[model samples]
Target chain A: MTSLGRGASVALTDLEKSYDRVAAVAGVSLDIRSGEFLTLLGPSGSGKTTTLMMIAGFETPTAGDIAIDGTSVVGMPPYRRNIGMVFQNYALFPHLTVEENIGFPLKQRGMPKPERAKLVGEALELVHLPGYGGRYPRQLSGGQQQRVALARAIVFKPRLLLMDEPLGALDKQLRENLQLEMRRLHADLGITFIYVTHDQEEALTMSDRIAVMNDGLVAQVGSPEDLYDRPSSRFVAAFIGESNFLPATVRGMEDDVVVAECEGAIVRAICPGRPASGDRVLLTTRPERLRFTDGAWSSSAPQNRMNVTVTEAVFAGERCRYMLQAADGTAMVLKEPSSAAIRRRAVGERTEIAWSVADTILV
Target chain B: MNLVQAIAGRVLPTTVVGLILLFLIFPIVVVMVVSFSSATYLTFPPPAFDLRWYKAYFGNEDWLRPTWLSIWVAAAVVILSTLLGTLAALGIARLPPALRVVASGLILSPLIVPVIVVAIGIYYAFSRYGLVGTPVALVLAHTCLAVPFVVTSVSASLSGIDPRLQQASLSLGATPIGTFFQVTLPLIRPGVLVGALFAFITSFDELVVSLFLSGSGAVTLPRRMWDDLRFAIDPTIAAVSTLTIVLTVALMGCAHLLRKRAT
Candidate 1:
């Protein structure tokens, strides 16, 4: 296989796509670095796929511009874009053999037959489907077909690759294995990859940076850790993983932390932006971060504590989950690792939960 | 009472279906048997088996001329209709839903209209253009009848294909024209082949439109066969009928096999 070299940087400036007065992708502007695996992650109808399609040149934007490596590609046809794309359904030509399908693009480029065959063989090996070139697409299993599709897309060594939910139809076990393989391929090729998927875990696992989209716009774009640890919005916090929100009244700001009062108890949370005193805000934290104050080894660090009654308790295999109601009737959840040495809290039990100020984020 | 109902449910449908099958096939069987008769005229229960009528059909130039005309006309119709019909189907597939329904209905109107009505219209229209009694007239009229079948067959095949295949081809750097030849055409080939076969059979067996157009210059096999039956009753007519039946059935069988392979 030819070395792909460094990938191209892509920039979308106020890109928009609408049909009959209804917008499918509304004003999305994002900058993707060269050789980075950027994932457009969202739920269905969030315009992630539409945004990817526009970048691939399959869809013409209603307004704004798309630039690849500082060159405008907005009006270019898909065939002239020189970009590689893989669809969710593994859109292999049903009549063509695996080798023919992979060599199709090279043939269109007027590559000699012998040279095309060589690249096709190397691509098949890269996708781990060596020596299966003579078979038709219908003869292969679903996983095998997807591998062929990936091989076909990358066989020509396109600098930039676009994938739209490529692993969506596979079973969970196969999807996980392919996900690791894709990540390995990305590292090996040093090519920029723009992946679109609604699976949050897939995005978090594979992306160098993720753009979480909602309602046809980017809600937040950051590294997975940044989005999970310090989400800038309530939607980002709730969408990334499980979160507990506590309504609080901001007293004042102290440096980067906001001092707030919640459930008649004083609390401090790290805020991304400054909020005025008396501002009502929601303080969010992960369920696993809250600990029972009665336990020994409680740290001497400043902790935000809340007094609550356990409304529900269930002993999961890996952890004990407690649903609690604060004195002001605000519902919250706390999870503790399952261990025989730790006492389990029962329903109706009153307890004080403590978490460090660093774990709480004011959104 | 339950046993009677059960027997009636099973026996009634079986008897009715068997009777319908016999009703449909009995005439063809009689014609086929008479074609092999040693008699001088058309008659069932042959006194002896012989190939005299077949030999007569092969020897006579009057009969051979019309047969060749029919074959050539059908071939021309197949070529013209398949090209037009395949293009029509492709255009229809890309149409918006509401307009698509209207366009398809218009294309298929030839099938829904009465044959005699279409024949009369074609005859009057072609006479004004001095196309009557010409091979071009027969081909044009037959193409009108055959195009609907081609459109229907090709449309069925087009629907079975995944539209994303074309997009994938385009994104892989193949031009639109290249994508159609490499991906779209190969995938929808079975439908096109079936449509061509239908077009050929439609022209070969057509009698009503041929009657209007095949005056004296272009006398098709069906037109000559009608003349033979009306003027002279002979076992030769039975022989031609058997041959026509075999050709039509073989063509239909080919179409059926193509459709099966496509699925």
Candidate 2:
């Protein structure tokens, strides 16, 4: 789905941003590959948007260097940066028509009228809003306006695009539709996309790489699978997706797996020689990874097993979610597909929760 | 509700508003009607209606000169105040809250101070420079009174424009100055126009400063009218007043239309 467009490689080294003596983005360093869709994912005030702003040249970095295609652009002004940006509010010029808005960058570059009009028409077609060139932004719907903004940003064919929560204002269904469209556009343009969003799910769905930020620093940067399956910190594990974290004490090691005692239950995780015996760690596992022992092909020797009392059982269409409390009152959720040959556990029922070592990780 | 109480509830406000309107418009109406009278002296409820007074106002050179002087002075004042006020508003829009407050108060001080005090101060300053009776002095003095209205109008318009629109323009490869011209200037035109109108009317109707600054060649309409009031109570003065009122009303209507179009 990659488009025929050039992309630039961006690298930030030891970036530090502070406002009024308070650090907004502190010492962030990341390399963005050409044509890669990298998302800065974090909650509000977590410096993700600030980092995007810094990259867009709208915010001056107090310390550090940003290089585009191996050239330092630390002092370059925004107008000279040759980068496209879409603001959260869409920021379409209300006074200009759609064609004029898309043609603005070309006009600024002193492009001739004929060529500019052709490019604007192509941009309109690219955003699937052909014949909408004559209309003003106020005459368009929210979603259509958002598409126009996107079209305007890309019309000049900049090497890099920066978006700050571009779809945060749309409703859920439209947001989802646009999320797919954005991913497709990223692929089609083949331009490096540095997207910023507080929604982790959008980042996971669209980005080739996700930079999970906390406070003012990046907690982890990895692919979606890597971030989900092997989070480096507790913040990444909790922020990326749902996970039940249990305090564990390392017990023993066998091959690549480390055995640990979690509360009153024995747990095991696939470890690469990090946790030594007697070391404290947090054992985390996804709810869907756990299973009820009686329904599943019973594992004669599972790595982890705990006796739990079913506190609440909910049938959530696609999956049956069971909220269970272990013997030590540590709550855990076990999700099993409704379509699978699984027995549903009722509330207040006794059960045994089992999971293999491959499904858990110690952070 | 009973008929009397309901009628009173509605008719009371209507009657009060009608009385206030009558009170406010009565003098202007009387002046308009008296201006049309054929009598040579100022007399209401004349015996016959004639255009002789309007003819006298147009045919006379002294009255015509002052009218031309007022128009030119008001035009010059409008240009000066609009320029200074728009620039001042732009500067104030970017200033921090505390400094902006101080700046605004300083700029609007002329409006808050008594007109007579301002006029006396200007007269003193202009006399020192031998500019007491110059049109430039009159224009400068009028500009000081009119700038605050321009500032307030432009400031309101500037606030209405989203700051993000400027940021968006910058992001789209327009420089700050370019953004101001391309994005900001057009959006704030209504405010600037309103300010210009205010400056125009302020200079046209100004009497306090004009009384001190206007001389033989630079006499404004208001100053000439004051002279006529002191010397002769002619029906031509009434005709001039009717014309001034008409011009002011037409200008206000234009301002209203401009504001409506802008929104």
Candidate 3:
């Protein structure tokens, strides 16, 4: 119940790691705030795990510096860094009991036997594994072993914790439960947590800020809502969640929004930078944002509308997903909440889909 | 045809296995029976049974000296070989894949090379250093033969453990050396123990190398038995063989128990 160590802010300056001249983490620079739960979300081979290893001192950076609380840890050994790390495979010591494993770091620091035991007990309780300390790691199930690994990592009260896909080996159901528990633990401990995972949904559910990585570089870093609602690049948009990308040409600027012409229709979208008129661009929007114009819903704000033919429709339990083809032969998807009040459109039906201009973004 | 094939599949292997076991065990049974013979000459199916040969083996100073020498040399080999072999296995495990193959094959070459060839080379090498007749010579030579077994046993268990456990220990604030002692060493202890037992047995039962390096001053039990067998038809050699077989089996059982406890 007591708070863990105070969080330490980390600053990675131009961190780079390469193997045989091929860069795994190519020019990554980010400032992580204290007490933040930041998830590195990316596909495999995106260098997310490699970056985490650099911070943990397992992999030496080819260039750049890693500073924790304003102190450089470039050449410092992992032991001297005083950081906590949880491996994906739950690397628990098979020779030691749970209590001994949790007490390992404390014992290394020369904490007295009695004090170490007390801290180990508190750690087990923190991870909801009380009274299981006497058992060996092999005696416990996979989830329990991971909990013990977590307890061991935090029992030393490390200022910064790095987890490399800690919940990766667990089943989906257990992974979901542990994700919430990890979030609660992050809140309670108030220590910095840098997690690496390829699962976007897990990152979205847990991270305060998610760094979406692609091709060995960070494409975008922002809050989960910021990433989902306004992705900065095509890679981020496609990696984070499903998006309907439409090719368009810039016509002119309307105040701050860019007016783009798509499929012979005028579409207005928000762009962070100004584009010259007649420049080609791509626009992206969420499926759920698109609605059939035949509905009674109407907004006073200006909207973007497109006519499309339903190529495929699936009546999902909670939502109806319809695949549509635009007039220019571009594919798009529309999702609507299933309700008896709204009639479901059959395949091959032509309909006009409307969305607010605010929901659309030019990437 | 199906019934005939099934009977052959089961009965053929059972009969072959039974014959092979009997062939392997017959010499040991013969020696055990001969150890209890009252006949002064080495003879099987003795007219009467007694313990004179066992008494002669236990009471003779020449036999006792060699037995003690063998035991002490084996103990020393176990200590030296286990330490060296465990370190070698650890080094091999850390090597890159291409280099690891070369290093592992080099370490295990003694196992594949003929013992007589190794003995001749060691004899000439140790004789040049004037160590051919000393206990140190036997200990050193036996350690070379014993080390390969230790390396093999320890390597099997070393490869079985998760390398991440050491990384985890280091990340948790344990120094690299501390991690080895606290985590790595304990996990591979069963393998080390098994290796030590193998080293002991290898040195204890060694004859070809002892025949080459073990002069009169450092004659091991196997060398003394060989000398007795070539010079005289003594029943005392039978008693010694029986005792050696018992010691080897008991040590092997100890190794098996340690392995079981570890798992």
Candidate 4:
């Protein structure tokens, strides 16, 4: 088969997959642009793995189209997809030498002997394991074996590389190192990298854009900063990064801002994606956005302030995290510079935590 | 008191194990002893040691022909059944759990059924098709008898293999078929060999099916021994039975080796 040309974007339109009518992936529609690195970030069983498998042509989608470069690949077998995929288990052929395993795909594609050898060589070089071709998979360490998997995937230069938690099996330090390596490889090769992971930190550090998934649906799609600073929903606010969500009722509305009251306190927030006026709202603010105050809401304070008692304190490297309990007893987590902390509060100390209206995003 | 109790605990189990071992091995020992009896009749602790019976086995033309036929037919059964059964096992292992259980039951049903009923049906069916008394008939019936063993052993072996081994092969860019041939077949070969040995031994030792199905032209060793028993009790017969026992033991040893290699 002739190889599919580059600039062929992988677009899934209303893709749905169900197993025994359980609806594993419920109406997942996505556009993964050519040469873009997109990570599908979600907790386990949220259907991110299913969606990735569907794109790799392993699990057939129950409904909708998956097109590569505008060509529908609904019933195409994985071998014919011209797509590279890495499994969580790092499924290298144990019987074959590492060199033979790397050459396997090219052999299947009927690349001539000389050409296949040249390509395999280039791949080994790219992965920095140039002389590892003769070694068996068992002979190598976990990280080296993972590098072999990556090299094999990129050897044929498939238009898209689908990774199903490829680093999920590695140790923490190894996983982070692979994350940075993958980010660099995705940039250097200019191939569309569709990464799947449950680790929020991994998605934040490596991807060009992240699609936060929950229960088989794309919850939110945005750059890291966008997802961090202005999440569009309560799920997104909680799933993407840690955030303090307070159940609040909208007190009033400005041009685009809403004043929501919770636990005998009022705070101004930008309406996240514009929920209706007078609606029950979820007010979210990051821990770093919160600042410790001297037990009073100053008139010149940015916009929103609440008086609460610090119930617990944690010492993070550069900051001290304080858990403040409002009168209604909803614990709010906030971080402040360690030096500026109020002598590091004990369990029952009182302090007012404040943030600007610009800091809180109401959904 | 403590020393006496410890001695009794160790000696009691050893004696019990010795009794079980003796009970299991006594038949083979008696058979070998009776084969060498100079009186030319079945006896335990043979009255006299002699090579006359062994010589009688070689001199008898009827005995030599059927013995060779049995050996050749068993080899054929081993070759054909192992190939078919291994492929079936691989396909069955890949199927969903419910389908796999159903397929396995159907394949192994012959083993569960009574041999007399199977022999009778095979006899009537072969005779009607003009296949009775031919070596082909015996070989085919024995192959069917051997196939389930092949299926079971191969399936057991394939089950122990990691399924992700195939998926790993595919993600390496090899097609599903390529993965099966290269990665899967090699890993499951020990199981296949174990099945092959069983298939060979089953065909070699089979009596009822051969008796009912063999024509004038086809005479396996067991069938020959059965016919000889009706006519007369000969020293050559005892010699041949002893030889068959030795060969069966050797084949079982090979099976043991194959099973250990599989793990």
lDDT string for model 4 (B1-263, tens) is 98888779897889899999999999877778788889867766778989898988898888899999998999989888998888888789879999999998988877889999999999999899999988888878888889999999988988887766676566556787887788888878888888999999999999999989876789999999999889988667778889999999999999998898666
DockQ score of the complex predicted as candidate 2: 0.74
- Candidate 1 at residue B98, lDDT? 100
Q: Write the per-residue lDDT of candidate 3 for residues A90-124, one digit (tens) a residue.
A: 99998899999999999999999999999999999
Per-residue lDDT of model 2, residues B20-106, tens digit only? 999999999999999999888888797689999999999999899999999999999999999999999999999999999999999
lDDT tens digits, residue span A24-113, model 4: 889988888888889999989889999988887778999999988888998987777878888887888776788888887888888999
Candidate 2 C-alpha lDDT tens digits along A157-266: 99999998999889999999999999999889899999999999999999999999988898999999999998878889899888998888999987788888886878
In model 4, what are the clashing residue pairs, if there are any? Answer: A8-A69, A99-A133, B133-B214, B133-B215
Cα deviation at A157, candidate 2, in Å, is 1.1
Per-residue error for A6 in candidate 4, Å, reads 5.3
Which residue pairs of candidate 2 clash? A2-A187, A3-A188
DockQ of each: 0.88, 0.74, 0.91, 0.47
Q: For every model in order, what is the iRMS?
A: 0.6, 1.0, 0.5, 2.0
Supply every candidate's count of residue pairs whose N, Cα or C atoms clash at under 3 angstroms: 0, 2, 0, 4
- CAPRI accuracy category, model 2: medium
Writing each residue's lDDT as its tens digit, candidate 1 over A257-350 gives 9999999999999998989999999999999999998744378776888889999999999999999999899999899999999998889999
Q: Which candidate number maximizes DockQ? A: 3
Give the chain A TM-score for each candidate: 0.96, 0.95, 0.97, 0.93
Error of 1 at B241 (Å): 0.9
